[model samples]
Target: MPKLTKRTIDATEPQVVEFFIWDESIPGFGVRVMPSGRKSFVVQYRAGRRPRRMSLGPSTVLTCDQARTRC
Candidate 1:
């Protein structure tokens, strides 16, 4: 995984954005911003031959450390 770049994404009070990391030539990991401005970490791994979407949960509800543990 690559380093995440911190930057402002939206003008709203709850800003939403995304940070990506390349793993083994694939964008296999990233963090997504929710409408509430919460940051949730995500990992895109293949389930057999198909891709899957997994939620790490809301930022306030789950800390980055917690989300990482989920991943």
Candidate 2:
């Protein structure tokens, strides 16, 4: 996917099924487009072999830069 930018995020439309658009530059940093048309920033990583996913917040409340920093 392309770099996660405000433009890209804003341009993303929700699919029939929920999916994620991952950041090319930052591992685990991505945006989730839900079927309900909700977009959210999230970070996925492994914590001691167990996978973990954390929602940073809704895209409305967080910027790409802010979400990247959190990751």
Candidate 3:
């Protein structure tokens, strides 16, 4: 995994299958690239032993810094 950054996020290319690129610096913070070419920022964590994932927003609408702040 690479550290999440504006440049890296902007440069990411969508894959045939949806995949996630995790942030090396922020645990559980990552970007999901879908086959439809949409990118979304997400944060994963555990709440009372139940794992959960939340989408912050599309990468086009939110910068890496903003998503990191939300995380």
Candidate 1 Cα outliers beyond 4 Å, as residue runs: 1-27, 34-38
lDDT by residue (tens digit), candidate 2, 1-71: 88888999888888899999999999898999999999999999999999999999999998888888888
TM-score of each: 0.52, 0.92, 0.89
Q: Write the per-residue lDDT of candidate 1 for residues 1-71, one digit (tens) a residue.
A: 44432332122244444443332333555566555555655777889999987776754476545656677
Model 2 deviation from native, Cα RMSD in Å: 0.9
- RMSD in Å for all candidates: 5.4, 0.9, 1.1
Reference-based TM-score, model 3 = 0.89
lDDT tens digits, residue span 1-71, model 3: 77888888788888789999999998999999999889999999999999999999999999888888998
Candidates sorted on TM-score, descending: 2, 3, 1
Best prediction by TM-score: 2
Q: Which 10 consecutive residues of model 2 have the lowest summed lDDT?
A: 62-71
Best by lDDT: 2
Clashing pairs in 1: none
**True lDDT of residue 4, candidate 3:** 86
